[model samples]
Structures are given as C-alpha cells and as structure tokens.
Target: MGSAVLDIGGNTGALVVVTGPEWSGREIEISTKDQDPLARTRAAVRARHTGAGTRYTAVFPTLPAGPYVIWRTATEPAGTVVVAGASVTEIEWWQLP
Candidate 1:
C-alpha cells in the first residue's frame, strides 16, 4: 500500500533521500540545475517502516523534471541526479561508497 501525497505527473517528479539513522533529524538540501546555488529546497530526514525494516529518508513530493544537485552543505555539493517526470528519484545515501 502507498499514499497519495506524491503528486508526480506530467513534467513534475519526486525525490527520496534514503539515508540512515545517523542522519535522522538532519535536513537534506537539493536544487534544480537552473536555480542559484544558494537557493535550495530542504526536507528533514524521518524514519519509515516497511516489511524490510525501518529506514531514514527525506521525501520531496514534487519537483520539476531536470538535473538536480544534492547539497552536502550550504556551499558543498554531495552529488547530482536527474529527475524524470511522473516518477520518483531516490538517493540511497547510506549505501554510497
């Protein structure tokens, strides 16, 4: 079962940051490529439980499809990803090497 809060469709998409308990209560930032580096959207990391187990994550429910940068800090970038319309983009931070 899923929820209806994610309104991804048309030229819009969604993003999910799959992190770990260590990142709980932290805010994760992201910005579309065309936006100023200083302008970013943020979401607080929360815990979600599924059949597998409980996991920490941040969900950006809706965003315009395009290249986006994941910020490590206000001035540092951790990585980048492309968001596709009508779908969800996920970043598994805990699994990063």
Candidate 2:
C-alpha cells in the first residue's frame, strides 16, 4: 500500500492515480521524461475509504516538476502528465491512452 501523506511545494509535487479494484495491490511505475525509460519509480495501489465511497489509488507522494510518463507495463506507457510545483496532480487510470 502507498502512503496518503503528501509534502509538496516549491519544485516538488505529488501524483494520485485513481484506479479500479482490479488494480488493487499492483505497483504502478512512472518516470520523468528527461530520464531513461528504464529508470522508474513504483507505487502500490491501495484502497482509500471516504465518506462518499471507497477509492483505489496509487500515490506518488513527492516528485520533481517535469513531464512524467505513467507506465502500463514494462514497455508501454499509459499516459503522461506535466507536474507543477506545489500542487497535487490527479489522474484516472482508465483515462490513460
């Protein structure tokens, strides 16, 4: 499971990937555009319970500002997002292409 706590500011930010139950327990990988595709970071999908309902998410608590590629597999990228400093970026897993 991933940590819900986030500390973002300045040249740092965070990413939240909302996923489905099928993704639970899976580790999602991401890499900055400037880095080699083989260089990646991983976060585990966890269930979050809220007043509205339960949500499955993978949280990248801290990351540098840049274009990041979210990988669907070792050789496939699901999508990309430009992360800005001092912000929390959220994306739905199913919306990736």
Candidate 3:
C-alpha cells in the first residue's frame, strides 16, 4: 500500500491529509497539545486502514477549522468511492478486483 500527503494552511490551523489503500469511508478529528500538521495527518492515516478492495486510501491534512463534511465520490466510470473533503488532500487509485 502506498500513501500520499497534503498540506493545508489557514487562519484556523494547518491541516494535512493522507490517502492510500485499505481505507474505509471514515473521518477522524484529533485535538491534541501537539500542533504538527504532518504528525497529525500521519497519525490519522495510521489509525485508518492501509487498503482493501476497490476502496483505496486517502488523507486530508488540513481543512477549515470547524465542523466539516467528508464524503466519497466515484473517481471515474468505476465505482470507486473517493474520500474527498472540501479541498482535495490526496487521492490514490487502486486496482479493482
């Protein structure tokens, strides 16, 4: 499984998103003393799956600080649900069964 990273910067805070394989359509929010966006993104990705099935992995490093929504969309004609945020963090296309 391969991983990709995206960096986000805003008045709220810095954000990082990651994507790869074995990822479920899930979103995670982390609030900690540490303020490293990269670390946070990495931790978030690690918490998620590596890869599985047509569902590939994806990561969002940063998003507007506040309540947000993360949804899945088809990359192309294939039925792969791409986990996308308000802003694209990282996108990875995996092989289908």
- Candidate number achieving the greatest TM-score relative to the actual structure: 2
Superposed model 2: Cα runs more than 4 Å off: 1-3
For candidate 3, write residues 1-97 as lDDT tens digits.
4354555444233333344534445443333223432233223444343445333333445544443323232211211223334454332334321
Each model's C-alpha lDDT?
0.86, 0.92, 0.37
Which residue pairs come into collision in candidate 1?
none
**Which candidate's lDDT is highest?**
2
Clashes found in each candidate (C-alpha, N, C closer than 3 A): 0, 0, 19
Ranking by lDDT: 2, 1, 3
Cα TM-score per model? 0.90, 0.94, 0.24
Query: For residues 9-76, could you state the per-residue lDDT of candidate 1 as single tens digits?
Result: 99999999888799888999999888998889998888887898887888999999999999887888
Give the Cα-based TM-score of candidate 3 against the true structure. 0.24
Off by over 4 Å in 3: 10-57, 71-97
Q: What are the clashing pairs of model 2?
A: none
